[model samples]
Target: MAGVRKGGDLEEVEIDLGDASDPEDLDEGEQPETLWKASSDREGESIHSSSLVDISDTKPLINVRDPRGMNDCLKVTFEDVIAEPVSVRSGDRVWIWSHALFEVSRIWVYRIVTVLLAIPMSILSGILFAVLSCIHIWMISPCIKCILIGTRWLQKLWDVVLEVIVRPLLTSAGRCCGGFNIHLAEE
Candidate 1:
């Protein structure tokens, strides 16, 4: 109790690491209780804000040669707040575990796109059917019937061959090969 105080608050935590001349010289009273300790008031205190008191008359953040180290952490920021950010769903749908499966506009736009693409494609198909019928035909009546049946048969054969040979090796091998062996490829 020669230099120890009873009521005065601890203004600074003095770390005398280099003062230990011998390992046996460290008595029970001389050793600190904790291995690593820091004042809680250093929270959010910028290193540039505090200045030196001796030369500059302020508590400056100096890069000491003895304790040469620095620690930094990752900081994620959105808009203005400094904390965890929330991801907003931009669609009207049921979001399940960060994934929205029942998208309203997704299916709607898909249907709309299919209809849009189908309109032009179906019109072209119809025109192609008419033009093919007109080819290699002298008689109008019989030729029209033949063209209709021929076109239908050709389309069926093409669909079969495409599904069996082309599609099995290309787009949908699983579905194409599944019903192909039983001669049930939508004749």
Candidate 2:
């Protein structure tokens, strides 16, 4: 879709093409000529104009005289322009620039609205996220670290208790139960 905006106020227009005959059945080297019609609303009334032209022909549609092998369909020669602004009023008839036409006012409106809302909303969300992150780092992080340090100290105390008290008791019990047989005899 294409749009032409002149000032702060945006005016939208649309073009709708009716079902036309397909040119696929034509034989090789044959091009199909189509009756093209274009219409617009003027003062709440329909105004239409039509022309007979070959729709399937791929030859340059804009320039018919140039033989320089430039097949560009939209080659503009500045010489063709009048260089003066032609006065056109609302409801006045205007010629269609090309055979093809399109419009996208609704999509354009949605896009602009999304962009407008996104800027402020993103800033607010970013500020909220930063505040939460600071709280987690400054307040919650030190508390978690202290808990981790306490757990490590407890683990070291448990190891020391096991080594000093439990290991000797287990060894003496094993000796009394004949678990180890070591004897010295002077024979």
Candidate 3:
């Protein structure tokens, strides 16, 4: 799925090329060979104006010979940022990326949200932990265990909020990323 921001909406466009092994399949032996079509043409119309030489056989798409529109962009990939999380056991690597997610962030807004949310959540969670600990020591094992279980739900809610709220704002206002933010210069 590719994320595209068109007309003020950040959309996830799925280009499911089940097997793009051959471009020939796309051309009914007669794919439109125009550089661009008439702007006035109705949607889905094959006819277009302006033509470019047939270099389709050489490459599936054209290189960015022009960067008239692209400015201030970042890219992210799965293997680089989240994969190979630090090991839990010393000298033992655990490839536990079962829930790995990447996100693009604007420096200012993301930092502000982090500061606002982190301090309160951390303090509240710490207090909850301490209270739960005391409860457990007082033989209230089930109640303490319940709060421990609730933590996982809170984690999931945080994940959803980040995706639904944070990602959209950042992509539209901060970066040109759909889900993940721009990649750093150094891994």
lDDT of each: 0.52, 0.58, 0.54
Q: What is the lDDT of residue 106 in candidate 2?
A: 42
| Superposed model 1: Cα runs more than 4 Å off | 1-106, 136-187
Location of the lowest summed lDDT over 10 successive residues in candidate 1: 74-83
Kindly provide the TM-score of model 1 when superposed on the true structure, using C-alpha atoms.
Answer: 0.20
Candidate 3 Cα deviation (angstroms), residue 85: 29
Clashes of 3: 5
Model 3: residue 186 alpha-carbon error in angstroms: 64
Query: Which RMSD does model 3 reach against the true structure?
Result: 29.8
lDDT of 1 at 167: 72
lDDT by residue for model 1 (1-187), tens: 1333346443444333343335476676675333223332334433233332232212244534234344223221222332233575433343342233334455677789988898899899999988877763546778788888879978899899988899757766666766665445765
Candidates sorted on lDDT, descending: 2, 3, 1
Best TM-score among the predictions, by candidate number: 2
The sequence of per-residue lDDT tens digits that candidate 3 reaches over residues 1-187 is 2332245543222232332334555656664343322232233322233243434443443565245645434443445555444554333223333323233334556788989999999999999999988877776777777787979889899999999999988779755444576767975
Model 2 CA lDDT for position 45: 32
lDDT of 3 at 82: 53
- What TM-score fits each model? 0.20, 0.27, 0.21
Ranking by TM-score: 2, 3, 1
